[model samples]
Target chain A: MTETESPTGSTLTIGVVKETKPGERRVALVPKLIERLTRRGLKVVVEPGAGAGAQLADDVFTEAGATTGDAWSADIVLTVVPPSIADIERLKPGTVLIGFLAPLTNTDEVAAMKKAGITAFAVESIPRISRAQGMDALSSQANVAGYRAVLLAAQRLPKFFPMLTTAAGTVPPAKALVLGVGVAGLQALATAKRLGAQATGYDVRPEVAEQVRSVGAQWLDLGIEAAGEGGYARELTEEERARQQQRLTEAIGGFDVVITTALVPGRKAPTLVTAEAVRGMKAGSVIVDMAGETGGNCELTDPGKDIVAHDVTICSPLNLPAEMPVHASELYARNLTELLELIVDTDGKLAIDFSDEVVAGACVAGRDEEVN
Target chain B: MTETESPTGSTLTIGVVKETKPGERRVALVPKLIERLTRRGLKVVVEPGAGAGAQLADDVFTEAGATTGDAWSADIVLTVVPPSIADIERLKPGTVLIGFLAPLTNTDEVAAMKKAGITAFAVESIPRISRAQGMDALSSQANVAGYRAVLLAAQRLPKFFPMLTTAAGTVPPAKALVLGVGVAGLQALATAKRLGAQATGYDVRPEVAEQVRSVGAQWLDLGIEAAGEGGYARELTEEERARQQQRLTEAIGGFDVVITTALVPGRKAPTLVTAEAVRGMKAGSVIVDMAGETGGNCELTDPGKDIVAHDVTICSPLNLPAEMPVHASELYARNLTELLELIVDTDGKLAIDFSDEVVAGACVAGRDEEVN
Candidate 1:
């Protein structure tokens, strides 16, 4: 596949630098991506120890036909994490840098990226679609976050989830209920069920009931009906909300572990589980709210901390994906590689054509001056 | 049934109290329980306007055969949320107090419950079993919490979850992943699905893959075997932990929402999702960590706050369940009534039977005082 598509006349140069942040592992460009880049006549340059944490030796870059040199002097700089203001200050204007800048809420970080005069490609900003699936960062890391949330819950939960017939006594299975049905919520349900808990789920969208039922657990519908354009929920009518809550209240008293994941982008999360419900739960019941970063769904939830309310503990953790940085970075790097190839031209030259929907969508935050 | 069991009955005194905590909407005992108590030849006494937030008026309590009076002076004192330390101190010695008392981490509160010499029963400490399920505060409340979490996540999410085919374009369904399969997690999953998102779930327990698949999501297994005695996972082994990371890294990129519910009882929550995972996620993705009350599963999750990292926002909301306190209280009241009826003696009298497993298990937390 690489032979015919190789850029014969020119070779493209991309730079890799050591991440300044302490405890930063994983590089933006991994050695595994070299063959693809080489076939396109794209040459990668790396600073010393760029891939040290990932165990990719310096010689590995050389073996892959990548040049070892002064990283800051390259036409485009590729980084893992975000570069510090000082690092950006050293860069020449019009240079392109690709990595996770955390643009949405990182005012200072986004400004820094802009000030660097570098075109930024947030790997985390990749869209989710069949064509963009390979470059979707949210899925790569959320998968880790979901797996980890369950492990955390299992550790703190007092009793087992599944029922057992023991000689001593009959141990009933734990009833697990999932809220929000998002990536982490689904993972939590799967994890709880795997642990032998009888799983059930609730959602506002009646259409999701099938998905919930497909998971071998009962699908709890609050009888909420909603329709919106382009994968966004139209705001609910107050009456619909009331009916939904009414149904939810009646269905609530049976579960053990309550994992909540509900949120609106760029807004405070709505509350799903109420204090009275927490009080109604069994002793030693546990809840892990994944929306802690945006606010929380459980009344007892305290973002980034642990609080026991009415004997029910609500836990909200931050940076769930980073805890597994090794895999996270690897996945993100692959995504970056895929996204980069699409933007690069056949001449092995840099070209970001925003006319393409994928490029335009991914480049939403960038100003005209940031990229050509 | 009520007429059949009236031979040995005398009017039992039931007491209700106002919560002393700031912004507390929950009353001592709700109307549903009061009706049950009254049916059992119990005279119900409630503080004026006790159930206002719960929408049960004082007239309703009075009409149901309850008397209004100073809750502190009643024969039995019940309050929602938790009583202030001062209220505990003021209670008469040996008076029975029933409410949500967070005992494990609140040593001072536990000490107060003990020092006051009140036979305090933390409603949340109820055991979870077939017979004891009705009394299970954790289950009842978690159900509400789980429902609320999904709403919160949906509200905060940038887009709606369900797919839409409109004149504008084909809007692919938002993708959601759930982390744990506990009650809250399941609810979140169901809610997210209903909101029109493609849902997926993962867990450390392989047994839950079927459940996740049943929920209409393609289940991705981390392939880490669990070692839990009661169908719960013990702390993961170090090697298994690495494998888990690998599994999540492969799966996280496509999700638009992630809900996390992971915790351990009486212990700090294990760090599951890390910052790298957050960075790897898409810019608009939102993560709701339900583990905020415990030390969060996400390393970057801050309890009771909203934070944006790597363009992905993480939220850990505190007291989410309280946001919808009215229904929460109602559900709890029914659960308590069911529980109280289960333990009520045939003589129309309250009985504390330590010999019963339900009572024995329920009497788990608190000041550790014993009363007959």
Candidate 2:
């Protein structure tokens, strides 16, 4: 294997294609990363207007050593979203595809890629081990979503987040409670605290209390610890669920803003904010339900809508990272770059070692049935 | 005069009227202040749904020692906006009225109140003195507008306001600039800083440099000063204005967010942000023009509307205080209460003292020829 040589002794080409999903403004590769790929003797081809959504013009990509061409015909295709079935038909048998292919849920897409004999990598399927942390696109995008959720809540709430002493009187700081102290929830708490709100974080996993406090927010303990394997809370027992709901309902009323980010990998999001809890909240308070895509953490949440229930604004924005396309695309590109470094050999030849845990875990198609 | 007696030997009746102006959600009084008025032996009457916009139900006011009735018929009418001609006609000849009368601009409204023999006190006309600071409704409302402007800018921006270090990469903090150093501008700078943005403030009045720095923002010095009378900047000379604009255009390009609050009394807002400046800014940058009601400080601003010009979002929301009706009403009610304490004698009878500077300055009508 040599620089600029693929397994078949031809120049290896990485293609950056424009995202086709509706409202998906992020791009998988940014111009800033073009040099890194090209420096390794990889030829870069970007479809015209591929990075437009992320504010990178075609000229910028061209200036960064990328050529405008048919990206679908390249050796490897980079995308923000999973390619459609029609897009899969455009790729050669040995072509490699990489992006957020929902392997667990979009089984049909995975089967289609397998039938086409295309090697595919699902960013969401990347292992959570220490070595693969830089390739964790889910956590990177969730960080953006969490930060955006707080800004949306602040914009909609008819009050100041921080306390202020003016000529008329002093206004007390708004109290914000974040349910589920995952990466997104912790980021939401940090953002709220940055805006001068008195922030509090709650999670069924008691171990996350220290992480919440590190962001300058209080930790709410409800005495329900469901620390499950793989860093997720276990499904609560029937009795535990009832107790959690009652305690959360009582505690929610005291906060002016609430952000819910509890989500199960392959299950509907748990209903953390019930209708009764919403009714008890003060008028003009805000709730940003980050689990809107998975049936929402709030009982009254209408996915991808902003509604007022019981005089409280409930915002359930889907794909919040797309709303902030520039930074979201930049981070996603970096995550892809880290993953690329693992699969691409030091000599710049196409090489995928299945023995590597990250490479094996992220592969969804074009592998032996037993290995898969 | 007795505690329960008016000039006409009747109980002093203070009425809280529902604001009739379009999009004006704030009421003249809130339920929390009802007991304060009643404790002075004054009878309080609230129009039905007067505090609805502020989330204070009619029953809440009634529970706080107020009665639901025809607010227009009370001896003293309290309002959030200047009353219309039809409303003035409903008032008794000797009735006292107070609110943001816009005495200098809305001359016809003042003349109508005078012709109807109603004693009108424009909150905007309140003298800027230490004793009258609590009665300065303009300052109070401006503070809310300033705080909201930053939030609006943050929401519209596609990037995070604060810097973040993640596994993917580090995001630099957003740079925010505020043009004007008045109450609203100062608050805008403080709020932007609170959200962790690198904030800078610019003002024609060089004296406000200290106030800008006190809010944790750098002062942009253009080497041109226009210190005017009565705590406002004077009109800049043509040469100085050209020099200022040229310098500002260069400085504005470096900021991600710009909030403009530069306005002259009874005149169109100065063009602090030119069209060229908007074009010079990076794509997805935001500009919130707080001077929208008096035209805008931005060349491309559409007053009372949110529009994008030259790839920059320009939000010129009018009456921002009304958008946050809860705190806006609370602060305005407190300001009115402070003014009421000055006019309402210890015996609880109406005392019109022209000798007092605040009273004389605030009185827009119902005074003798010279005193007015």
Candidate 3:
């Protein structure tokens, strides 16, 4: 066996494992990143068919200097979704696991990883500092989801998104309204504008108006300010919520397409498009709820299904990023690459530096004492 | 009784009938057009539920000055599709009928109309002259099909149509190519370009290169010219066809999306994307064949279905314009309005002037002698 294969070898081995989550098509790593890791004197091990969902074959990874072998015993393990309890039992002690570990929600899984002595770094837990921008997988995946949501809305709507002056007559451009101003909402507005739609954005936090305008979209302000800590809008009060819904119902009637992405972290998605709002909209209008997995932001939204209510089509597709596997995986793999560069030493050995805010913020388990 | 109810009255009455063809969602007129027709001093009657498919309610049509009643007994009948044998039997003798009668192919339907002594005007037979441009239903419907085709291709593509630069990385825009730079092809290229794709156009007729360039798309020339009369490319010779296919195979592989709209009147659509070319395309690429009803331009296309072949999605959607009923019906109604102006006198009486070129060309049956 090669010296790199030894359990206590100096050379670090990064293992790429296939995602086991149902309907999850993205991979933790891609073939192009294999060379980036290998150039750092790290040996890369990929499980068979690891990148199949992302359209990256095993032969492509092998051609990029990766070996097809058992990846579970490597020094560093990469994944897309949180590992199952059975998968946690398979990990060796002191293995550095990198992925979206869902540390805040998957309590049992976090406890199981601690029992297994796996040093878990949740990508979602990465501090949203300027330095950790490149390692933010949540933002990267949300960007893809936002772009795909507009295309889905366009496909279901019977009218054209862009204006065209033809021989018969002139067709007016469709009006698109986005109900959130985060990364996904901004990207959705930008994409809708690119397709020649008249795009508008709304958010509880009034500060995001400039960011929305920067993407060539007008901002709809309802005079509510709920800017919470950590870049998320706080839950609105009962009176404010009622007033917002009433204003939104009136505003939504003027739009041909409405994309709702409002979410309160660790809580159910806020209902921005009430059933009354849906009724107010035009017959051929469409609504794409990006927060479908979080119980949707529309009252009429049937999570994970396409349904028509009040003459409006509402598509609440779960895991929208998985539908576009190629680009989604590429961006996620890049995020992992940036994070790996921080935790791996120049000499190709595993080194955990808790002094760094990103490492300290992302680490949830595996220390002499509890780190969570 | 009203003057329009009298058989020998000077007043003229027009009837809008519901389309009976399966999958045809468009109507001959919309509620918005009722006022325009009423202003011409003509009585209008609409069959119940005629505009329902286009999202136009019966109350809306009634509010616009149209009466719901027996439309088949009106002096002139307006429809979107050719009347079936049973429908033709319902028409009054010497009644003026207007729509896409498919005179060139539906011989049985034309014979039935003639046996019933119905004066049939085929919208497809309208002369391609400046004065008749507003009455060209084929061009109007084709434009809708073209715009929808790009949307279909964009929806199926795994990558974004436009280039996106995010915090994680930069994604290049998709390259789209359209075959047959006719009205539909030009619209497809323009739509793709609007969606921020690198668009290209190719046609057998070299004269359309300027038209393609006007849509902000580069034209791909295979050095084959088949320009024919009536603004359609003539059938190519065997040698020319083989050479064009070979060159197209090489060029099509480089595009992320391909939309084919080539057709030769009554002939089957020419194969532009061969099976070999599909195999050469990258994974997750998409192809939309607009000529699915006439046999697709892609060799592997399954007409009226969306299928995956050689890692490429080939969508052969039939009656694409029907999918967007609102705009399709609106445009078609405008075309019929322009045609009605040619036949209806200012006195609000039936006065078919054979001297008019548009009237003479569009007339298919019911005369002292056969006009065909």
Candidate 4:
């Protein structure tokens, strides 16, 4: 352990590393967060260009009292995504690595973490409870993705989102249909509504209709309820799926823009917009599939590509949160800060209390082997 | 005359030609308007792929009773842009060519039209009066350009336009500053407001402050009045120009988006956003120069390109109205239809009433040789 003691006390060293994932433009921490951490008696070491993706220059971090250096020697490291195998090898034994570590699907990384004897906390594993709401990084990032998806659709769509009466005639507002009512979906609906688009939202869970209405968007009732545990939609029955698809196909044809955010966690995103439905849409319409990374909710969506289907533009963008990194980083940094307070004790020492529900739930590796 | 006599009467032939200007996507008439023309006992002919840029397939025009043929042989030829020298040569004598002929700037085209003996009506020459409001193509096209400029800025901007309140914190709304309060500038302000941006506008004319305030944007007063004749800003005095530049340079630094639409009709667009002003703007801020074609208002703007200067993305788009061809065409076609009604007689014969103010103002050639 590379622990150093100051005259006042032993300060907890927090390291921020630049994301290595291609097209990942968001940083785990920003310059504003550096002062907040330093004020809490924590020493921050940021790798050069770590916050460049977020448009936060290295000098800005230094101005906020963060030291410019190689952060591999720090006690705790912060990352937005799962670190590469090479990066995992750089960490010292017993070093704590924190991020959206997918311990369920990334078994290889989990095994490597065990071999390296490094403690790992997955932000994705944070319980969706009232107290942990502020620490929910997934929800924070999803909010950004949701807002960006509407803009992408608006930019791609040939028509205006709002209606206007001019000397020539009145141009009607664009009709938008949003699939799913999660954090990302709600934000998309709110953004579309704000842009003056007549927005409608659909979710498998019937209870989210009220949330959709709260954002000034109409609720699309499919007449089927599939609300699952933990606020996720359950896998639908064959009959229910067929009926849902039929209703969506008929309803989606009337919309000028469609934003799909339906995801089943680690599973493939459900097909909400079929090829026939896309063909039925008016020419020059736009569809933005937010769940493109794990197989899109649209049948015709090509991940990371803008494709035209029957004259309708379908954009399957990956890492939308990264595209607007300034605010994205700010939100993510705050989430990590809240989570850090829970993981660290008052003496500036790492304390993983297994008895604490949040600690037990978010702990992916480091505790005795019961993690997925 | 290429008039074909039907059993009912001798019908007028209205021809639509493809625009030759590079990056010009708008067609003079869409398929939707073809039916309106044909209903007035008029024969409609469309050149192959004339409406393709506007996403209206040739079959759609044919379905609306328009025949695919060479438009040059028709008595009345409609175009979106001024005809090329070669196109002028193809026109028969007494042919009526209608479009936004830059009568003031294109001296060669005006002389060519006179030599060819073609009756030309420039849409840009249409007088801005109450009765001619429906025929104002400049205002119609400029409206589309302004709305599109905001969308372009929003797409390129790294942050959200609206004030978003999330669990992490509240992200303040993006501040947008629009220079000039013409039809385009006003539309841009409204669009930015619709997107939830806190928009501010600056104009040399003091009277347009009410127009800016009407769109819910704060009026930026440079304390120098340069309101000129015909509703355009006059040439600013050197001392007044200096004061305006100084105030703008300081004010522009605070805005996230700056849209400059200051154009003096025939003269080179006034340099509104200087290089020093651009350098003072925040990094990742956007500047959309709407007066790009008539020599940009921003010093750093390279027409038809997106350049980053002092960390600010300056987009000088060429033909923004063409990018949104669907509605742009609809509005332009309506303007042309209203203008056509004034020039064409009740007996379905070509008649140029030089005594009518709308006709006299719109006529660029054929009302004696001195019209150009």
- Candidate that scores best on DockQ: 2
lDDT of 3: 0.88
Expressed as tens digits, the lDDT of each residue in A161-261 for candidate 4 is: 88867887778999999999999999999999988899999999999999999999999987988999887899899999999999899999999999999
Residues B24-110 of candidate 1 have per-residue lDDT tens digits of 655556665576677666667787877765556788788767888777755456666667788887777755667777766666876
In order, candidate lDDTs are 0.66, 0.89, 0.88, 0.87
The C-alpha stretches of model 2 lying farther than 4 A from their native spots are A1-9, A369-372, B1-8, B369-372
The two-chain DockQ for each candidate, comma-separated, is: 0.03, 0.70, 0.69, 0.69
> Model 4: per-residue lDDT, tens digit, B203-293?
9999999999999999998798998987789999898888889889999999999999999987899999999999999888999998888
Give the chain A TM-score for each candidate: 0.81, 0.96, 0.96, 0.95
Q: Please state the error at residue B10 of candidate 2 in Å.
A: 2.1
lDDT of 2 by residue, A178-204 (tens): 999888999999999988899999999
Of the two candidates 3 and 4, the one with more favorable TM-score, higher being better, is: 4
Candidate 3 docks at the CAPRI level of medium
Query: What does candidate 3's lDDT look like per residue over A139-178, in tens digits?
Result: 9999989988998988888887888677778889899999
CA shift of A315, model 3, Å: 1.3
Candidate 4, residue A109: CA error in Å? 2.3
Better candidate number, 1 or 2, judged by TM-score: 2
RMSD of 3: 3.1
Computed on C-alpha atoms, the DockQ of candidate 4 is 0.69
